[model samples]
Target: MIHMAVTPKDRSHIRTYKTAKQAWERLEKLFLGNESIQSSRFEEVNNAANNFVMLEGETAEEVHRRLTALALQLTELGATFADDAWIKRKFFTALLPYEEMKSGARESRELIRLLWPTETLPTDLANLIKWLETAPDRFIDWKESAARAGADMALSFVLSWYDEVNLDQLECRRADVEENLPAENKTARLARACAIADFVDKRVFIEDPNPPSDDEEELEDEEIEMESPPPAVDPAGPPPAGA
Candidate 1:
């Protein structure tokens, strides 16, 4: 059963194991390795994170994605510092390529400041990448635009997503609020603020920003179910990986 269950490649490892328990353990070690094995993987990723130096033509967005993915992978292995300052420091260290003391330090500061929005750097990983990818200058424009709308515009940047308010009726309601925001915006940011969260929450909605189309809705309504899981090696044994 074990021989039939695993792929041809994985079968090589399980073939030598005599019992079901032994075969299962081998498979676990191969995929979700034990603590010691995980620690070794963590050390490898940690080294990559620490030794990261920007490639000659690398954009900050690309470098940030790579470094953050590595850092997240490390955190999954074990607990570590995830404070704002700690992450920022690690990110900066990976970004700059120091050539000389004075020049490199100045260039590093300039590059780091490029990631800032208005008076402050972003406080989290997602915001940091967003700031970098959108270009800090654009964030400043968004900030100013929000400010002109109301006094508490900074809260507007607190980062919400449209999926939170993604019902079809809710979407149309949000669009109405945004359209009428100018009227409500004079007194306070309440309506405008609500509208803007859903507006800016859109990562990409240049054309319509409308809800799912009729065809899309029909496809969703008649969604196909996933295939049934493969049977276990034994009734008492766990289901295979594809399940």
Candidate 2:
């Protein structure tokens, strides 16, 4: 069985060993010699536990697989923590936005447990971590949709006000209305509408209707005309000596 388990390339090296014990000893000497492997494995385990981060586009399952693989390697190297809870705490702490995600995951898991009383779910920590991994995408989708709807609503209001005020030729109005005003008249209302439209356009659609442009050439021409000293007043031909 040992001979069958060994690959053909490795079998050649251990061909001299007559018994399984001898072959095992030979393999161990060739592979696990001294403390170098142990030291390297220890460093890897520490790095994994200390520096693990959830990348921007990485999903929860991917992170779980990565951490699980590291944990398994650590276990193989005979590293032990206080308990599973300690390990989990360390792992979660290493993740970005840990507290918010942890709380959200805890709530989601509780809701799932309440919904399915008899189902054989995984451990709380496991389920919570899983939820943490998967929840960001859904939350981002919801926020994006909500922002789109809000932009649409704001645009509708602005257009309605535009029609009511009949300010078809009016450009974008400045948002300078005083907060202490007791009542909003048509001008203030239109200004507020324009402000809302500008905000929604800039923030949601990333569209700037009136971006500032450099008028350096026009300014330079004006400055030259102003500074030219009126062509020396044409003194030779002027007749204002007595007048």
Candidate 3:
């Protein structure tokens, strides 16, 4: 089974192990898994680790939950982080990969520096998520600046006059507006936050004010037919049923 489980490239190393247990142990060293886990689970953990990253609109809590789920998967697969700090470090670096997020990613890294003042992101994951959720004030002025730039971008789109001089002046004004803006513009922030949360999520990664409840199942409505009123009883004449 171990022979079949190991990748072709790993065969050379495991072939000489002389026992299935030894071969499995070598396979564990090569990637994340245990003899107990089926070979597919072993491959899954490695793939998950390599692909782990913050999705564009995910909140801090969502990220934490995702990490927890991933950690559990690793445990089930008989793998583990070298240390708690290693998990935290992975959480810190899982920024979304997009041009707009690049600036935010750099800022986030710098903030991690101030929080840890270390070569690696050394803060506990819980503390980091708490700060991410609660740090709205830090983004206020920068958000306003982004709003300014966003306003400029919106106005520029509807321009009937795109003369060289007007364009030049507008460009200069945009530059001024962006001087104090955060790494990303308003539209990017909006995209990051998504519809209902809007800039709030972008400014601070947290649960939405009125997040949808998973427990609230939508009940299907049943259609009811009203019985026709009893044969339109005459106003004056009563029906004879023992009347």
Q: What is the TM-score of each candidate against the true structure?
A: 0.28, 0.31, 0.27
Error of 2 at 168 (Å): 19
Better of 1 and 3 by lDDT: 1
Those runs of model 1 whose alpha carbons end farther than 4 Å from true positions after fitting are 1-31, 98-243
Name the 10 consecutive residues with the lowest summed lDDT in model 1. 201-210
Q: Model 3: what TM-score?
A: 0.27
lDDT, residue 223, candidate 1: 66
Give the per-residue Cα lDDT of candidate 1 at 85.
62
Quote the lDDT for 122 in model 3: 29
- Scored against the true structure, residue 12 in model 3 reaches a CA lDDT of 59
Error of 2 at 233 (Å): 41
lDDT of 3 by residue, 1-243 (tens): 777865675575577778888887766665654555566776787688767888867876787678766775565455656246756776776743543465665677677554334346525546555666644754553565455555544455447454344544655554566667776686785674443233232332232345445544222111112333446757888777877
Query: Which stretches in model 2 have alpha-carbon errors above 4 Å?
Result: 1-31, 94-243
Q: Judge candidate 1 at residue 42 and give its lDDT.
A: 76
lDDT of 2 by residue, 1-243 (tens): 777987785675578789889989867855575689778867877786677787666776676667776775565455666246755765665565765776776777765554344456556577656755665664554466546655666757768767665444434644664554456576787777667655453223222344435687578778899988765666577787796
Top-scoring candidate (TM-score): 2
Question: Lowest-lDDT window of 10 residues in candidate 2?
Answer: 201-210
The whole-model lDDT of each prediction reads 0.60, 0.63, 0.58
